[model samples]
Target: MKSTVLTRRGALKCSLAWAGAAVWTHRAPRALGFTNANARPRVAAIGTGSRWCQRATGIDGPHGSAPSFVPFGDYVAVCDVDADRLGLAVDVVQEWTGKAPDAYGDYRRVIDRNDVDVVQISTPDHWHAKIAIEAMLAGKDVYCEKPMTLTIDEGRLMCEVCRKTGRVVQIGTQQRSDESFLTALAIIRDGRIGTIKKATCAIGGGPTSPVIPQVAAPKNLDWNQWLGPAPDAGYRYLAGDNGETQSWSRCHYEFRWWYEYSGGKLTDWGAHHVDIATWAMEKGATGPTLIEPLAVKHPVPFSAGFPTDDTQYNTATEFLIKATFADGMELEIRHDGDNGILFEGTEGRLFVNRGKVAGAAVDDLANRPLPDGALRAVYKGKEPTDHFRNFFDAVVDRSEPISDVHSHHRALTTCHLAGIAARLGRTIRWSPTAEKIVDDPQAQSFVSRAPRNGFETEV
Candidate 1:
C-alpha cells in the first residue's frame, strides 16, 4: 500500500476497483431490484452481542443485531465466540434476508473470505483493534463499535491501517448521526453559544460486584477466544434470579466493568458523551493537555495503575475526571449529574444528550432557524442518517463517514487518559501533538499494552 494520505477521490477509485471484482451473488436478493444492487457490499458481522442494539432504542430489538444493514449490503457471514449469540444473529439475518448465512466461531475465517468486502464489528473493546486491523489488511472496509480500541496504541495502529488500506471505515459513535446532537452542534458552531468555555459530560459510573466465584466457561462460549488481547483470567459468574442475571466474569457484558478489557464507564459511556463534548468544543482533532482525577473511587486497591483484585468488578464506582484542552477549555467526565453534556460558552450555555437539546441558544433557534445549511455543515455536507446507513453510504461512495477513526481516537484518548489518572490516583500531563504522556513514564505506560501471544495488533 502507498504511504500517502487516502484522499476521498483515491478512496472512490479503490471502491470502484473493488466493485469491478467478481460480480456479487446474493442468494436471496432481498434488495436486488433496488439501488446499487449490482455492487452492494458483502457484509460480515464479527460480533453478535446486543449492546450495540441496547445502546440505543429502535435500531434492533433485544438479542438481535445487524438488521439495519440489510438494505445496503448482504450478510455473507456472521461470527461470534458465543455460539448462542452467533445462532441468534444467524437467525436474525436469515429472517431478514431470507437466507441463512454461514456462521463462524473465529473472526479470522470471516476476514479470510474474499467475498466479504465490509466488516461490522460489535465485539468487546479488546478485540476491536485486532479484528479491524485484520479486516482492513484483507482489503475490507470496517464499521466497528466504539471506544474502537482497547488501548491508545491500538487506536494509532487502526488509523495507520485505515490510511494504508484506503478503505471506508466508520466508528459506531451514532451520536454523530443523531438529530439531537447534530442540532446542538449546529447551534453551537453557528455562534449562538458563542466561544465555548467549558463542557462537561456526566456519564454514569460502573457497578461494584461481590467476589464472583470462578466458574467453568459456558459450554457454548469460548472464553479464551473472547478474552483475545486481554490477559488470561478466570471466568467468574453469579447466576441471576428470574432472568436478571449478573456476571462478574471477565467476559460478555461484564467485561466493561473490568479494567483488564475495558476502561469501564469512562470508555463505555464516555465514548459516546465525551465524543459529543469534544465535537461540540470543536476539539475533535486533538486530545487534552492535562487530565486530572478530581476524585475517584474504585472497588479494589490499585498499585502501579493495575487493579489488585480480579474476583470482583475493578473499575471506579464513582469518579470525576477533568481534562483540560490546549485552549484552557475544560471537559469534565463525572459519575454524577444528568447523563448528558453541558456546554458553557462566553455568550450562552447549552445542554444536549440523546434525548433533547436545551438552552437560550436553542430557544433562539425557534425564531431564527439555523442558517440553511447549518446542520448539513455539521454533518459534513450530508443529511444525518442512521449511523449504520451512514457507514453504508460511505462504503458505496468510497468516502469517510461522519465518525471517522481519527477524531474518535482524539476523543477516546481523553477517556483513556482519564482512566489512567484515576487508576494512578494522580494528575497526568499529556502532549496531544506527540500523543504521549509527558514527564511520567509510569503513567505513559498506560497508553499501550502488550498483547497476549497470537492476539498482537500491528500495521
Candidate 2:
C-alpha cells in the first residue's frame, strides 16, 4: 500500500504477508487428501449462467472451440443469478461429472465452503473484482474471466488481495496460452522486431440493437442479484408476446455494449488483443503514463464520464485511443484495421491474432524456429497448452499462473483509461507510479466508482 513502484515480486510479497490472517480464517479443518498433485481440486463455477457449457461444449456444437474445464478439475458446484441459466449449467455439470454439483444463487455461499479449492469467476465486469477478492480471502484460487476489473481502483485492490492470499490466479486472457500469440511474443521478446517503435490493436466495434421497452423480468431470474453492484434500473425486455427472454441488447453477452455494466469493445476485445500487445512490449505490470483520445465516438452522447442516456446502450462504438508509455512506446487501439495486434519495430513488423501469426518474423520462425522452453518461459515456465490446465497446475504447485493479476491489472488499466478518455472526449494524463489521473480533478474522480450500497466492494 506504499507509494512506490510496483513490481511483480514486490506485489506478491506484500500480498502474501497481508493475507496471512485470511489464510488462518480459511484453515478450518476439512477432509484431507485433496492436495496431491494427481488429485483434482474441487472447483466451483460462479456466474455460470452466461459462461455455461460454452467453454466445455462449443457454442456452435458439442465440440465448440472455447476452453473447457471438465478435464482439469472437479466441477463440484455451479452458481448464477438466473434460475433458468443456473439449471442449464447444473445439467451440464451433471453430464460432465456424472454426478450432481451443488447449485446456489449467491456467490458468497459458494466461496464459504471449505471443500471448494478453486472458483471460476465468469461474471460480468462489475462483479469480477468482488468475487475474486472474496474467493481469495476464503482461501480459494481463482480463474477469473478477462478485463479483470471494471475500474482502476478495483484492479489495484484485486492485486492487493491476490498478493495477500498468495492464491494462484489466472486471468482469462487466454491469448497468452495460444501458440500463435506465444510465438509472436517470443519473436518480439527475442528482439526479432528490433527496438519496438509502436504497436496497434484493432479490436472491432460493438453491436447495436433496436430500442426495447421496460418489461417485467423473467420470474426464473433474480434480476436484482443479476444487476449486482450496478445502479438500480428497470429490466429492459425486447418487445415480444411472451416474457421468456430478456432483451438481447442488455442481457447476457450484450451487457458488454452498455457502459453501465462494461466498457464495450474497449474492454471486451481490448482485454484480449490490447493485453497481448502490452505483454509483447514487456509493459504488463506498468500502465500508460498518458492516454490521448485521437477520435472518439460513442453510441450515445456523454457528459463528464457518465452516460447521459440510461435507456439506450452508451459505450464507445468506434474509437482510436492512443496511449503513451513512460518509455515513449505508443500503442494505438482502434476499431479499424484487422482484428489483431500489429507490432512495428525498427527491424521488422509482425501481426498476430487467433487466426494467424504472420509477417517477416513469423515467416523466419519456419526456418529458425525458437529454442525449446521459449513458450514455457513466456508462460512462467509452465505448459502453454491450455489456460484451464495451467490454473489447476498452479493451484497444485502454488506458482503464479501464465496470466497473473499484476500484469492483467496494468493492461486492464490501459483499457479503462481509454474508456475514460473516450467518455470525456479528451486527453488524460496518468501517473503510473501513483496510479491516478494527473492534474485534472474531474478525470481523477472517474478512477473509481461508488458502488451501490449493498454491492459496495470492501477489501
Candidate 3:
C-alpha cells in the first residue's frame, strides 16, 4: 500500500480546515434515503468484542437510547478475532438493519472493502493505533477506543497517519462529550479554580501477581489470533480446573493488569480521569514535562518464590506518579486517593467523581451564576448527553468531535509516560515539543516496542 507523506505545513493547513469546517457542518455521509444516498458513508465495526458491541448498540440501537434517528448508513461489516463475539455483533446488526452483513476474523479484510467508509475500532490497547492507522491508509475514517495508543510513538504515528490520509479520526474518550466534565472544564477555564496549582487523579491499582493455574484456551476462542501483533505467549484462562473462578489478575478484560497488553489501572482509568485533567488544564494537545513514580510498597513478599515480578501484571499495584506540565501546573496520579480528581488552586479545591462534584467551599462556586451563555456554550448548544451521539454527529458532519484524537493523545501520553516511569522505576524528564525523553537513553527506548513479524505498524 502506498502511503502519503504530509509536510508539517500541509498538516497544519488540514487541521485548520477541519477546525473551521467541523464545528457547524455535519460531516458524515448522507443517510440511506437522502438524495445522495449512494455517497452515504458505510461503517464497519472492527474488534466486535464486549466493549465495541456496547458502543454499536448505543449508536444504532433503539431511539432515545441512541442519538436521534439520523438515518445513518448501514453496518456493512463486523470484525473480530473471537468468532463468538463477532457472531453476536452480526446478529445485532442483522436484527437492527434487517440485513445480514459480512463478517471477518481479520480487520484487514474489513479495511480492504471499498464499501466500508468508516471503521470503528474497539480492539485491545495495543491494537488501537495499528488498526486505526491501517483503516485510514485504506481510505476509511476511524473511530477508535480510548487510550488512543499504547505508547507515545504510536500516538505520534496515529496523528501522522490521520494527517497523511486526510481521514477523520475520533477517539472514544467519552467524558469530553459529557456535560458534567464540560461544565467543570468551563469553570476551570473561567478561573473558578483560580490559577490551578495542583491536581490529583486516583485509580485503584492492579492485582499483585499473575493468575495461577493458567488453564487451556476456551474452545470458542482463537487465542493466537486474539494475541495478534503481541508476542506469542502461553495461553492461560483465569478460570481454573474446578470451574471455580480464578484470580481476576490477568487475561482478556483482566489483560489490563498485564504490562504486555495494557498499562494496568493507569491507562484503564487514567484514560478517562487523566483526559479530564489535561482538558481542564487546557493541555489536550501537549504532554507532561516530567514523570516520576513514587516507589511503591508492595504487600506481597518479594522473596515468596511466586511470580510476583513476572511480566504478567507488572503494573504498579501502589504508587504515586507526578506529572509536571509546562505551565507549572502539576498532576499527581496515584493508586490511592479519593478515587477521582482533586483540583486545588489558590482560592480553594474541588473534588469530582462520577456521581458528584464538591469542593472545600464548592457550593459557593456551584451556586454562583456562571456568566451568561456560559453553561449553554459549554454544552455546545447540545444537551449534556450521550458520548456515542457526539461521535455519530461528527461522522455525519465531518467535524472534529469533542473527544478527537488530539485531546485523546494528550491523555494517552500521560498514561504512557506513567507506565514508562513505573516500568523503569525512575524519574524521567520529557521534551514534549521534541516528543522525546531528555538525557535518558533507556527511558527513550520504552516509547515504542518491537512488533511481531508481519505485524509491523506502517505509519
Candidate 4:
C-alpha cells in the first residue's frame, strides 16, 4: 500500500483557553514525511462503532462537540466488526473528509496499512490492549479509548509495549485536555490546596439490565468476531419494562455491563475521575496499597470471581471501594454523589467534574492566580488544546502525550482492583512496586486472563 501522507490542514486548533499559549510546538514537522507545514497524519480507524459517531459527530456539551476526527488525523481507512456500522462509518468519514477511505471488517487490515500513521482504537474495552499492542508492533502509534483494558494485566502489557516501541501513544481520557481539569490541577500544584489527604471520586453507578434473553445474531453482525477473546455466548436483549420505549443488548453499548467484555462503571468512569485524582496527588506510577470493597451490589450472582450466570449483566450496579495509598492518602470510589472528584487537603478542598471546578481552591485562584505557564506545566509543558488536537500535535512533536499509558495504567489498576474486590466480595492487598496482588493467588489470577488461541494479546 502506498504511504498516504494525507493533508491535515488546521490540526493546530487554538483553544480560547490558551489561544496563543507558547505557540504549541516542540519540533517542526519532518520535511520528508509531510508535504508541507500543514500536512496531516493519515489515520486508520478501527472499531468504527458508537464512539466513532459520538466523537466524529461532535455532540453538544460543556465543550462544543462540533470539531471531530479530522482534528486528530485524516482517515485513510476504517474498520469495524459489524458490516452495517462499517458501511455507515465509511459514509460518515467520506462526508467528513470529502473523500472516501478504504473499508474493512478486520482491524488487522487497517493496522497493516503502511500509509497509516495512527491507529485509533475505539473498540469495546476488551479489545483495546490487543489491538493497541498489535498496532504498536506494526509501527503505528495508538489513540485508544478510556478504560483501556478489560483486565489489569493488559495495562501492564500496554506500558511495556509503549516503552519497547517508543511510540507516542495517547489514551482517550480527554478530561486531561479540558481547561476545567487543567485549572483544577494547576491550583493544587500551586499549593492552594495543602497536602492532600483524601480524594473521593463520585463516578456514579451503572444501570442494571433485566435478564437479556438470547436472540439470533443479525446477519450483518459477526457475533463470533465480536466475542473474540471473550467466552462464546448467545446474543441477548430485552425491552424496557414497558417493552417498547428502550432496549438493552449483550453486544455493542451494553458490552460494558458484562465482565467478559469489560469492567462496569468502576473502570468506565473510574478511568476519568481516578486518573485526575491520581495526577493531582502525584501518585506517579504507584497504586493503592489496599483496595477494599466497602460495599457492593451486583445485578447477578458472582462466584469465585466469575459471574455465575451468563445471561444477565454481572457488573456491580452500586458499590463503594476504599483505596489506601502509600502516602497514607485515601481514595474513595463510590456510586453515589455527583459525578466528579473531590479533593480534600489538610488546609483546603475542591470539587471538579466535566461541567465545572468548584470549592475554595477555585476562589483562591482569583486572589492568587497560578504561576504563568502553570496550566501548561500541568499538561507536561504543552499547551493543552482539545484532546484530539493535542494528540495530533504529539504525533508531530513526539513528546509524551498528556494521557500517556503509564499514568493511566497506575490509575486504572485501582479501578481494576476495586472491581476484583467487588466480584469476590472481599478486600485485596496489593504491592504497587511489585505490581502483584500480594496474598491470594486466586485474586492474583484475576489480573490476567488467557485469551483464546490465536487471540492472545502477547507482544
TM-scores, all candidates, are 0.90, 0.90, 0.83, 0.89
Error of 1 at 400 (Å): 1.1
**Descending-lDDT candidate ranking:** 1, 4, 2, 3
RMSD of each: 5.6, 5.7, 6.0, 7.7
Summing lDDT over every window of 10 consecutive residues in candidate 1, give the lowest-scoring window: 22-31
Give the range of the ten consecutive residues with the poorest summed lDDT in model 4. Answer: 1-10
Preferred candidate (lDDT higher): 2 or 4: 4
Task: Report the Cα lDDT for candidate 3.
Answer: 0.69
List the global CA lDDT of all models.
0.81, 0.79, 0.69, 0.79
Please write out the lDDT profile of model 4 over residues 142-254, one tens digit for every residue: 88988889888899888887876667788989999999999999988888889999999999898877677899988988888888887778888777652122468878778
Tens-digit lDDT string for candidate 3 (288-356): 899987865343433321224443455568878899988888999898867888889888788887777
> Alpha-carbon error at 28 in model 2, in Å?
12
Candidate 2 residue-wise lDDT, 128-159, digit = tens: 99888877866788888888988989999998
Candidate 4 displacement at residue 430 in angstroms: 0.3
Which has the higher TM-score value, candidate number 2 or candidate number 4?
A: 2
| Candidate 2 displacement at residue 371 in angstroms | 2.9
Cα misplacement distance, residue 106 of candidate 1 (Å)? 0.8
Candidate 3 segments exceeding 4 Å error: 1-40, 54-73, 214-216, 240-250, 297-312, 360-362, 365-367, 375-385
lDDT of 4 at 219: 93
| Residue pairs that clash (backbone atoms under 3 angstroms), model 1 | none
